[model samples]
Target: MRFDILTVLPGLLESPFAHSILHRAQKKGLTEIHVHNLRDYSSNKHKSVDDYPYGGGSGMVMMIEPFAVCIEKLKAEREYDEIIFMTPDGVTLNQGLANQLSSVKNIMILCGHYKGIDQRVRDLYVTREMSIGDYVLSGGELPAAILVDAIVRLIPGVLSDETSALSDSFQDDMLDAPVYTRPADWKGHKVPDILLSGNTPEIEKWRFEQAMERTKARRPDLLE
Candidate 1:
């Protein structure tokens, strides 16, 4: 998979893709991530990509030209499966969406900054709009990083144990059951005896039941 992110704040994304699973995925050539500076596409001599809103908004709005230029340049090189815009009003991102994107070969994400991008940009270039949640953020860079992490890890060869992604919470419309590591007896608290038992079939059943209970107690909406 290949991801190209457009942002004025590319520096903000340095850490997220440089460490952990994302870094490993890049090292193994399982995925590619490229960050582009929107300013680079600006025609202004000062490289300014934002301007005061036409209707006199309190904050400057990102200009459409830089985004249009960037998107067009990328499109000329190769077809993109999705050109996503990160915004607070877009479709709420979830595990199911992540799973769907995992199969996409090429993606481009535009990160909005300041007050947000010009409306024309969204209408003309974006294939999808995604939001991490109902809240707002200073910029879309962080959410773009988050969305990439959520999808990249689900790619077939990106994870060492492919089954791990399958068992993640929300994959089956239920929360994941609690898990334990070594030290079966932690002080007075003990690991579930079913997990410690050698009976594989029974253990699996116990996990499913626990997952149901957890989902019911927490996000019952998912069950519907």
Candidate 2:
């Protein structure tokens, strides 16, 4: 998969993909992540990409010119499966969405700053809009990075254990069963006998029950 992220604060996104799964995914040829500075597409003499709202809003609105040129230039190079704008009002992102996007060949993400991007740009170009959560943030760079991470890790060969993402929380609409490692008997606490017994069927059943209980206690909404 390929992802092109457009942001005014490209610096904010530098660190998120530089470590861990995402970095390794790129190195292994499983995915490509490109960050474009929107200011580079600015038409302003000072290279400003925002302006006072036409209706006189308190904060500056991102001008459409920069986004227009950027999107057009990208489309000319290759087709995009989705052009996603991260915003508070868009559909909230979840594991299902990430899983769906993992199949796409290419995507474009635009990060909004200041008040937000001009509505015209969204109407003209964006195929989808996504929100990380209900709450608002100062900018969309973080959300863009998060969305990419979520999708990238699910791609085959991105993780050392391919099944790891399949069992991630929310992939099954249930939380994960508690896990224990070496020193399971720390402080007199012992590993569950079923796990130690090497009874795969019984152990799987126990994990499912534990996951169901945890989900009911913490996030019953997922079950509904």
Candidate 3:
């Protein structure tokens, strides 16, 4: 999969793709992530991409011209499956959405900034709008990084153990079961007996029960 992200503050997103799973995914040819500076598309002498709102809002609104031009330039190069705008009012992102996007061949994500892009830009260019959560942030650059990470890790071969992504929390609308590693009996805390029994069916059943219980206690919304 290939992801093209547009942001006014591209420097803020540099560290996210430079290490860990995302970095490895790019190296292995499983995924490609490109960050484009929105300012580059500005036509003005000062390269201004935002302006005072026509109705006199407190914060400046991103201009439509740069976004339109940037998106058009990208579309001219190759077709994108989805053009997503990251904003607080968009649909909240979840594991299921990430899973769906992992199969997409190419996508474009626009990072909303200041008061957000002009509404006309969204109506004309964006196919989907996504929010990381219910709360708002200073800008959408962080959310774009989050959305990209969520999608890229689910791509086949991006993870060393492909099944690990499959079993991640929310994949089945259930939280992951508690896990333990070496030094099973650490400071008097022993590993569960069923895990050590090597009984596959029993172990699976236990895990499911644990997940259900954990979900009920912490996030009953998923169970419903």
TM-score of each: 0.98, 0.97, 0.97
Report lDDT (CA) for all predictions. 0.95, 0.94, 0.94
Error of 2 at 216 (Å): 1.2
Tens-digit lDDT track for model 2 on 40-140? 99978899999999968599999999999999999999999999999999999999999999999999999999998899999999999999999999999
lDDT of 1 by residue, 126-170 (tens): 999999999999999999999999999998888899999999999
Comparing 1 with 3 on lDDT, the higher-scoring candidate is: 1
Off by over 4 Å in 3: none
* Tens-digit lDDT string for candidate 3 (99-187): 89889899999998888789999999899999999999999999999999999999899899999999999999999999989787899
List clashing residue pairs in candidate 3: none
lDDT for 87 (candidate 1):
96
The model with the greatest TM-score is 1
In angstroms, what RMSD does candidate 3 have relative to the true structure?
A: 1.0
* TM-score, predicted candidate 3 vs. hidden true structure: 0.97
Task: Quote the lDDT for 212 in model 3.
Answer: 95
The local lDDT score (0 to 100) that residue 210 gets in candidate 1 is: 95
lDDT for 73 in candidate 2 is 97
C-alpha displacement of 215 in model 3, angstroms? 1.2
